[model samples]
Target: MMSGPAQKYVYTKLDQIKEGTVVNLYGVVKFFKVPYRSKGTDYCSTVTIMDQSNAKLTCTFFSGNQDTLPKIYSIGDIVRFHRIKITQFNSEFLGISSNGFSALVFEGTAGAPALPRTSSKTYSFTEEDHKIVESLRIWQMGQQTFSNLRLKLSDIKPEQYFNLICHLVGKAVLDKACYLLKVWDGSKCALPAWKVCVEEEALEGDADFLSLHQHLTVDVLVYDNHVEAAKSLKVGSYIVIQNLHAKLHNTCNENQAENSYLEFHLHGGTLYGRGITILPENDIDVQELQKVLTTVNLNEEPICSEDLTSHNRLSQKSPPFNALERCQQLSVTVLPTRQEWLTTPLSTVVKMKPPQKYRVRVRLRIFQPQHLYQSVKLHCTKCSSLQAVPDEERLDNILQGNYTNCPDTDAQNAYWYQSVKWKRNQENRTVTIHFMKKHDMLQIPQESLIMVEGGTFKEFCKLSRKFNSIIPVTCNQANLELDLSAPFLVQGNIWHYGCRNCSSLKSIEALSSLTLEGSWNATEIAKALGIKPLTYVFVMNLTLEDETGSLNAYLWRRAAEQFFQISASEIFMVNNLQEQLNVIMTTLCPPGKSIGEYPWMDCCIKSYHSCDGREEQNLYEIFDTLIS
Candidate 1:
C-alpha cells in the first residue's frame, strides 16, 4: 500500500487511491460510465466500487490520463486493479469529487486485473446510511453522503424526511413528495426516494414517463453533477440510492400534494450524471417470467352432468394462451380493465364510465358437432376486466383489486352486451352476446335455446343424452301441472294450437310471447316428413360417407329450416303407427332400396286385401313416392 506523509500524497485510505498509488482493494462494481466529449475527446471511464463491508469509493482518471479510458471496466464486473496511482480531480468543490481518480486499462493477458464472478445475493444498506436518513428528522442541518456513508448532502431542517420506507408502500396514490415511490424486489419492499423536479423519459415503447414495473430488475441512479442519471429508473429493477441530501423542511401541501414546497433538499443521485450498471441474474430468462404469469377461469359450473359445461375451458396453448384444436376465436378487450376494477373500491364505483357494447359474429365452417351460433349476455365487473387497459398502464394497475360492479347495465335498465365465441364443430360454431348488468329475474330466467345445427354421430349421441337428461327435467317443472285440472278451449281460437288438455295453452295468445319447450333432430324430422337423412351428416361423416349433394335435390336442401314443432308433453319416441311407419319408410330405408321395392306394398295390403305381385309392386311405388 502506498502511504505518504508528504505534499504530493494526501492523507486518505489506500482504497481511495485511483492513480499514483499502490493500493490493494476488493469490491463489486456498482456503476460504470465512460466519459466522452463532442470534440472526440474520450476520457477515462469511472466506476463506483464497494468493498467487502459495502463501503464505496469513486475511481476516476487524472487530467490528460487517456490510457485509463478504454474498455477495461464495466458495471457489475468485479476487478482487482493492482499497482495503480491515485490523485483527486481538480475542481472548485473539493470533498466529494476530490476523491475521483483512475487506473490503467487491464489487457487480456498481461497486467490484466482479476475479475470476480457475482452471485445472486443483493447488498443491503449499511448501518450508517440508515442512521443518516433517520438523523435528518432530529437535526435542522442538511448533510449528504457521496462516499459509502460520507455526508455529501445536507441542508435539511429538522424532521423533513420520512423516517422509514414502509410509510409509502401501499398508500393511496399521493401527489406530494416529489420522490414518492413504492418499489419491491420480489422479497423486500422499499420506497425509492425520487426528486419530483426532474422529468423522466418513458421506456422504449411506453408513454408513462415514470412507470417502473416492467423491467423487473433495475437500479435507481443518483448523481450530484448530472440530471440524466436520476431520470433513468425503470420497472422491475432493484436499486439502492445513497449519499444524496434530504430536504429538511419539505411538507406535502395540506390540500394538493403536487403543489408542496421543499424547505431543504439534496441533488438527485440520478442527476449525478452517472450511468448505472446492472448485473444479470440467473433467472432473467423469458421462461422464468412465464412461470410467474398465470391464467384465470371465470364462468358458471356445470348445471347438470350431461349439459355442456358453461363454456369451453381450453386456452390456446401457444406461447401465451393456446388451445388444442382450431375453433371459432375472437378477442375481447374491455374496461376499466379487469385489473383496474379490482383495485378500486365499491363506493368509488362512480369513477368507472358506463359499460361499452361490442358485437360478435360467428359462422359455421365445418359440420360435425351440432352447435348454436347466436347468443347475448352481460359481462361481469371484476379483476380480469380491468386488465384490458393498454400494456403500459396495465403494469401499475394489475394487482389493485377494486372489482365491485356489474359491467352490463345502466340505471334505467339499459344493457351493454358482451360477445362470446366457442367451438361446436369444425363446421358450425356458437356465438353468444353477454354483458355484466343487473338481471331481472321477474322478466326472464337464464333458460335460452340449445339448438344443434350440425353434429357428428358421436356429437349427436352426446347431445341426445344431454337434451334428454336435462331439458325435460327443467320443462317438467315449468309445465305439466297447469292443464290437467282445467280446460278452457271451447272453439276455433288460434290459441288451441297447444295441448288441448292444458289451460296454460290458452295463455299463449301470440307466438312472440310464448315461452314453449321444444326439441329438434335432423334424423327424427326426416323420418316423420319422408325426407332423406342427408342433412343429418356433417363434415365428419362427409369424409367417411364421401357423400355429395342431396337424395332429392329440390326438397332435401330446404329441410333444415323446416320445423318439426313439438309439444312440451310429447315423448321422444314415436307412439302411433303412422309416425312409426314414417320412420321406417323414409329414414330407415337404405339409400337405393326404395327404387327396387314394391311401390304400394304397405298401402295395397290395407286397401285391396290381396294383390298380384305386379299390382303389389305398382302400389308399393306409389306408397314409396308419397312418403319418400
Candidate 2:
C-alpha cells in the first residue's frame, strides 16, 4: 500500500507476507468485527482480509480511540494497514498492530472515489497506490455479496446475526444496561417478533404511524456498550443496527416456552462486530428502506396477537415486483408468494447466519451425482433420512435368507387381516399369509396389503403380481417385527426403504383406526404403522455461480420437485420423466461448455446452521425456486 519506485519497491502481497516482519499491506475486507471496547483500555477490532492470491489473513487492530480504527463499512472495502507485525498465533498467522501502525480505508465500488477514509489528512497517496486500490475494487465486484449485510425483518431466523436498516419509531429504557428500541423496516417478521413494556416511555415522528401498524414493529434490545449508541438515536431517524443477534428469548421457562419467541438482541459486546454504525442520510441501503416504508398500508386494520392466528401473522410480505416475469426469463423455481427482496449475491448469501431466507440469482456450475440416475433417493419424513432406492435383486436375497423364520400367528381371526398357510417353503412352521380382506376385489385383492411370515422373495413376487403390495414380516411374542435387511414393502420392482438407526417397527394393527379407500394410501399407512415410507426424492448438490461468487446448494426434497415440475416418484417410476429431468439438468449446466452457456436462475435461498450445530454442516440451500 505505499507508492514506490516502479519495479524497485512493491507493496507486500498478503500471500507473500512473512512472519516477524512489519510491512504495509492492502487487502479486501472479507469480514470485520467492529471496534468494541476490549477488556483492556484499547478499542479492538478484528478483520479478515484477502487478496487476488486468495490468501486470507485474520488481523487485529487496537487503538485508544475507536475512530482511529480501520473504517470498514462493507465486506469488499479496501484497506491499507501500515506497519503491522505478522505473527503466528494458535498455529495460524495473524496481523497485530505494531509501533506506528496507521490504517486507511477505501470504497470497494469500482470506478468510485479512490480517496482514503482516514483520520489523517496527510498520508502518502500516489498513482501506484491508486492503481492498487482500483485493481482490488475491480476484482471484488465479481467475488460475491460483499456490498451490504442489511436484512429485512421478515427474513429473520433464530440464532443468527444481521444488519437492520430501519426507522426508529419508539424507545423505552429497560434495565440499567439494556434499552428496548421499537423499530420497523416496512416488512413484517414471519415468526412472531417481540414488544417489551417498560415503566417509562418516549415517542416521536414515526411512533404514531408505527403505533397503528403495531404488527410491523420489532423490539430490539440493545445492551451494554450498545445502549449508549441507541440512546442518542432520534425517533423517525433512519439507522442501521450492526450485528444484531436474532435469538430465542433465554428467559422462557423450559417446561412452558409458549412465551419464547424470536427477539433482536444487540448484546453488550462488540466482539462479533456488533453495534449501530451509520445514519439514514449517510448510507445507501436506508434510501431503499425508506421507499419500502412509504408502501406500508396505513389504512390496514390492526389486530392483536390473540386475534390473529399464526397463519395470518405475516399475511403477506414484500410483493415480488415482476417476479413472474423474472421467473419466466430463466428461474427454475419461484417463491410460492411473490417476494419483494431482490436477488442477493451468493458471497453475501454465504456469510449470513442461518435460519433465514433470501432471494438470489445464479447460474448452474455443476451438479453432483454426475451420473444423474444416482440422484434419486428414498427419504424418510418422520426422522429425516436418505437412502438408495432398494434394489429388488438384493432384497430378494434377504427375503430368501429370512423365509425360514416362523412369523405368522393364528390370532388373525380378531383383526381385519386373516392368516393362511402358503403351499410351499414350509421351513418349520406353516407360512402364514395375513391378507387385508377389506378390499372389494377378489378373495386376494390387488388393492390389499399382504403380510407374510414364511415365504421366499420369489413367492412374494408371485403373490404381489395378483396383489398390489406385500410386506415380509415376523411374529415374536405376539409382537409383529420387521428387521431392516429387506424392503419393508415391495410392489413389483419397487421397494420401500427406511432408516438404519432411526426407525422402530409397529404392527399392521396400527392401521386399524383409519378408514380404508379402494387403494391404500402409502404415506398415511406408513405414518400409522410407524414405518417410514420412502419416497423417491431428488437430493443433489449444485454449484450456482453469479458475477459476485458461487454457492453450492442442495436441490432437495419439495424444492427439487417444484423446480422440475415432476415429483421424485414420477421421475423414478416413469422413464420419460427421468429423461425430462436430464434435459432440465442439461439446460442448467450443459455438457462440455463454458459457464456462459449455462442458464440463469433467479432464486430464493436460505443459509443457516445445521440441525446438529456442526460448523461444517452450515450450508446454502436452494428453496422457492423452479426451473421453467
Candidate 3:
C-alpha cells in the first residue's frame, strides 16, 4: 500500500531537484532582505541553501514574521527549516514559506550537509566607477576581491566605470514582481539601490523569456539617492565591479542636489595586498597578473584580407649649395690689419727713423681752367719742423679770410699735413692728385718704345691734362721710363686727389700710372723701391702738447686738423672769430676727394684751450651780471 502521505523530505540537492519532489537541504542560511523605508516599517528576509557544488536554493520569509528568524537564521549560520513548500519557479529551485513552518528546527537535513562559511571582506564604491560604467551605466570595471563597508551608490554615473571593486549578493532571478534577499555580512538592504542588466540566455526556463519576472538575477549598477528596482540585489550572485568615478548630477532650489549625498566620496584604503593590488585579498601576485594581462594584450595580431593593398610614391630631389665649397677659394687681396692707438705719452716721443718714401707717380686731373692753366708741381724741401702756430694767430687769419696765407713770417717755414697750395676744379669734380711710383715704370729705358694697349692710351691722355707727373715729386730726378699705356694713379691726402696720369702741363711728355708698394709705414715704403738711404715717411700725430711743455696742449693741432678730421671723421671749419663767437660757428665741409671727411676741426678744438677760455668767460659774465 502506497503511503497515504510522506511528512519527512530528505536527500535532495536543490540543483538536482525534480518536480513532484520535496527536498530538505541543510546548509548555512544565507539571508537577504529589502530595506525598510522607515524605522517603524518592515521588510522581508530571504534565505538560501547551497549544496556542496555551490548551486543554491532560494527561500523567502515574509515580513512581520522574519524578524524572529534573524536571531537564529542569520547569514553564515547553519540551520534547518521545516514545512517549506517545494516548488520550481522557472527552472531554478525555490522554497516558499508556509504559515505553519515558522521556527528553525535544531535538526533536519536535506540538500547539502549543514556547514559554516567565512564572511568575505568588502569595499565601498567610489566615483571612479562611473568613468567606465557603460555596460551597466554605473557598473565598476571589475576587481578580484572585496570588503564589507557602507558604499556610496549615488556617486556612480553613466558610461564611466573603469577602476573600482564592487560586491553584490542577492537572488539571481525574480518573478511576480517580488523577491527576497539579505546582505551576507550587513543588515538587509533594498536591491533598488543598484541598476540591473541581465543576459537572456542565462534564464531559459521562463514561460515568456523576455518577461521581467523571467529575469533570473537582475544585472545592475548602483546609482541615484536610493536603490532602483534593478539595483535590488540577491544572495549567491555577488558582483565585484572596479574602476569607478563621480561627477555632478543635478541641483535643487536653495539646497543644491549636489550636496544631497552624506557619504558619496568613499574610497577604501586597500589592506591585505602589496604593490598596488586591485585584488589584494587573493593569493595571486599582482605583478604576475599584470605581466600575464600585458602579454595577452601584446599577442593579439591584426588581421588582413588577401586582396588588401596600400602604395606610396617617392621622387628624387637635389640639394642646394652644391658648389659653395669651391667658390670660397678664389683670388682676393687682403689688406693689412688696422692700427691700434699707441698709449705712449705725447711728451715721451720716441725719436725714430722717418717713414720711407716709395716714389709714386701722381697725375692731378684739374677740372677748372685756373688749375690747368698753372703748371702742376709738388715742391719738396729738406726742411725742419718750425714751432706750432698759435691758435690766436691761426684764428686771426681764418677770421680775416687769409687761410691762403702762411702765418709764420719766415717764408720757408712749413708744417707737416699743411697744404701749401690747394685749389678745387669745380664743386662736382676733384682738382689735384698724388700716388706711389709704379714698379714696372722704374725698370723701363728712358726713351723706351711704349706700346699703347686697350683703352689705356685715352685714359692716360685725360689724366695727363691735369698733372705734371705720375711719380711723387720727390722721385722726379729718378731715371725712369714712360709707359703711356698705363692707368692713371689715384691718391688720397689732406688737400689733393684724382687721377694723376692726366695733362697738367702741355710740355710734359709721356705719363704713366703708379701704385705705392708696401705699408704706409717707413721701413716698408723704403724697402719697396731700389733706393738707398730713404728719408722720412710722414705720419700725422693726433696728440698735441701745451706751451708749458705739457703733452695736452695744441702741439699737434696742425696734424689733428688735417689727418684726424679728414681721415678719422668729418671736419668742421670755423672761419671767423666773430662768427665763431656767434654759437661757435661750425661748418661741416663736404668731403674733399683728397683726404675724405675728417675730425680735423674737432681735434683742433679739443687740443686748444680756446673752448675752455670761452666757457669760463661766459661764466664770468653771468657772475658779473648776478652781482651787479
TM-score of each: 0.21, 0.43, 0.18
lDDT of 2 by residue, 435-463 (tens): 76553222436446777775665676677
What are the lDDT scores of the predictions, listed in order?
A: 0.24, 0.69, 0.26
lDDT at 164, model 3: 27
After superposition, the stretches of candidate 2 with alpha carbons farther than 4 Å from their true spots are 1-10, 98-100, 110-115, 124-130, 144-149, 200-206, 232-238, 248-261, 294-628
How would you order the candidates by lDDT, starting with the best?
A: 2, 3, 1
By summed lDDT, which 10 consecutive residues of candidate 2 come out lowest?
317-326
Q: Model 1, range 573-597, lDDT digits (tens) per residue?
A: 1234225323323332224553223
lDDT of 3 by residue, 1-628 (tens): 1122334344454557554344444444333332222222444445565434456677755555323442221223344454566654424556765554533311112222222111212221223211211221111112111111213342333222223223233322332322222112121112112222333453323324223221112223222212333234333332333222222212234544322211011111111110001122221222333343235321232212310111000001111111121112110111011112122322332121222111111111221212211111222122322222113333233222311222322112111111122233342311222222344432222212121111122232344344322222211232222221121221111111211222232211222211323222222222333222111111222122222222212212223222212211111112232232222111112224432221112111122112454462110000000000
Clashing pairs in 2: 34-273, 143-548, 144-548, 145-348, 332-626, 332-627, 333-625, 333-626, 354-608
Model 1 residue 506 CA deviation in Å? 99
Superior candidate under TM-score, 1 versus 3? 1
What is the Cα-based TM-score of model 1?
Answer: 0.21
lDDT of 2: 0.69
Model 3 segments beyond 4 Å from truth?
A: 1-12, 28-31, 35-43, 63-79, 99-628
**In candidate 2, how many Å is residue 587 off?**
58
